[model samples]
Target: MTAPRSAAPERSVVDRTLSILGAFDKDNRTLTLSDISRRSGLPVATVHRIVNKLHGWGALERCADGGYSIGLRLWETAVLAPRSSALAAAAQPHLVALHGQTSLATTLAIRDGGESICLSFVSNDADAVACYGGPGRRLPLHATAVGLVLLAHAGDLVQKEVCSGPLRPYTRHTITSGTLLKRCLAKVGREGHAVVHGALSEGRGGFAVPVRDGRGVVVAAVGVVGAVDVIRPARLAPQVRAVADAVSRCLRADRPRVAEVGA
Candidate 1:
């Protein structure tokens, strides 16, 4: 009998290209060529050639420190993703109304993997220091009010993963303890909203409510942030919930169009 032929050795250009892109993620946004070589498991010479090509095409950018980071071109392309783009577009009017009514910083965010990614933010407070570099920035699941709301509805697996944490404390009040975070998440679920004080930043209080889709699945969180003393959860909850509900309504109304366009 003839011996079975062995499978050909793998050397895919697509796989190699993807490996380079995969080397950059949340914790490792910028990487030196050596880092990419190690992470991609490719030779330095191969990494060098690929990196140059990617940089030329605006898929990667060279940092001042001679490292590489995802380029703005990639971000600009990412925002056009149908789901997030549609959600943001549908929620924009409600967000604007909320900001106009509250005169505080309001944000819209969706849970992306382990973190909450801000999609839209509006603030008239000139003195308000930016956090996480503003919209498209990622915030910790255990810190912000929006994060709490998102985590509350993100299903048991995500909750357990987050609660089993080396949770970083952004401020003294941030819930680093898994047990404490679990209790807070329970409260958020029961109340249909989340309120956090000085957790993500000093002297900043936040309130958030869930924004659901047509199927009633929680898709995002809408939140407002202001001074600790000024944040009356009782008053803010109603406003936040109202705006979030309005956003949900808009999304549901436009769902058919969204599906058609995507199709």
Candidate 2:
């Protein structure tokens, strides 16, 4: 009998390229060529060719220490993503106003799969800001106020998948049980907001309200993070809701014009 052929490569060029990009994260911001190869599970030679192309195209930057990091060009391209850009633009003024009013670290985030991706963050306290993470950072759906709000409003499949267990615990207070998470999400849905204390970080709390679109679909979340004592759910919930409502209105107003153009 003829020799059986080896299995074909499972990933396409696009998949490999995206994998290389995805290899960089908050903890692994800068990586050597070998590091990329290992993280992406591609051969060093393959990584070398793709990394060179990506570097030349400004998607990746070569460092002085012979490491690679995501380039500003990638950020420029990413910010232009319609959902994030439009949401940021409409919510920027409101985010600023909220920060000015409360002097707390505020954030806007949207759900991507089971995680929440921060679109905008405003704060003066570096430590406070770091607790919530900067823009583009992925946060757990069950561990953050904005994340809980988003998860509560997400589709049933998405909610079920996230609550299926293996939920990461950022702190002792972080909800890790599937049954408990479902209960929490149900409460968030009924309340229309989420207030989490020391869930993602000890000694800190988060408050978030859902942002709806024209059809009243929850599309995003906005919230603030501060010391546990400073985050009074009763006091901050209404303020956060007001900002969310304003952003929803702005999104609703813009959607009609886009529809007209598409029409």
Candidate 3:
């Protein structure tokens, strides 16, 4: 016997709202109302209603084709998030200068939960592999130099969790062995930086250093990427470290002032 649609429990306002927003991602950038309904598994009427509200609030924008995409308002809100915003602001100038001098791709990233999200990037090389992607793109936490440095500083729990198993291989050089990866991460911790060669792509190489917060926490990573032959980690380590240090100082100087109890 088929159950009546009316017999199903109604979704909460929060759940329905989140569903509509969650329907958009890097792969699914824009979608029609029908597409949102299908992806969110909500009734069309519910999707329409929620989407209209979202559009009005500037959380979503209606396209000329009557499709919906994430709005600039939403982006503005996201960039204000303290975790990435403060770090990105501090790192931007350094990243730009590095990119200008080296003519290689320089990227700033922060660990978002389990993934590394690119916050800023500058590159002039058309032939350089897009392993890091651009700003707002997510990269694996175990494949590149930035990822390795982040994982190394992310403490034992994160290292164990990521290295336990199921590490996807992007190339033959990608470290699939949890044991070997653990060793590599240990070395990264000792060196205070990471250098990866052909790990994310067949010919790509990278060098990364940690960006510390006001409290001395490893809040982000800055790195440079290019072809394996020309990207020498040891040679570039000093420059990358200098930039990372400059950003760290900025973070400390620009951080919010704590209130005094008796003031």
Model 3: number of backbone collisions: 0
Model 2, residue 62: C-alpha shift (Å): 1.8
**Candidate closest to the true structure, highest lDDT:** 2
Candidate 1: give the clashing pairs. none
Residue-wise lDDT of candidate 3 within 6-102, one digit each (tens)? Answer: 8678889999999889988777899999999999999999999988999998999989998999999899998777777777777888999998888
- Model 1 lDDT-worst window of ten: 254-263
**lDDT for each residue of candidate 2 in 1-263, tens digit (9 for 90 to 100):** 99987799578999999999989998899999999999999999999999999999999999999999999899999887777888989998999999999989999998888888898999999897666778888888899999999889888888898899699888899999999999999999898889999999999988999888887778889999989899998889778889999998999888832211101
In candidate 3, position 183 carries an lDDT of: 96
- Model 1 lDDT per residue over 50-81, tens place: 89999998999999999999998888898877
TM-score of every candidate relative to the true structure:
0.78, 0.92, 0.88
TM-score, predicted candidate 3 vs. hidden true structure:
0.88
Model 2 off-target regions past 4 Å?
1-4, 7-10, 256-263
Best-to-worst order by TM-score is 2, 3, 1
Best to worst by lDDT, what's the order?
A: 2, 1, 3
By TM-score, is 2 or 3 better? 2
After superposition, candidate 3 runs with Cα above 4 Å error: 1-11, 125-130, 256-263
Which residue pairs show collisions in model 2?
Answer: none
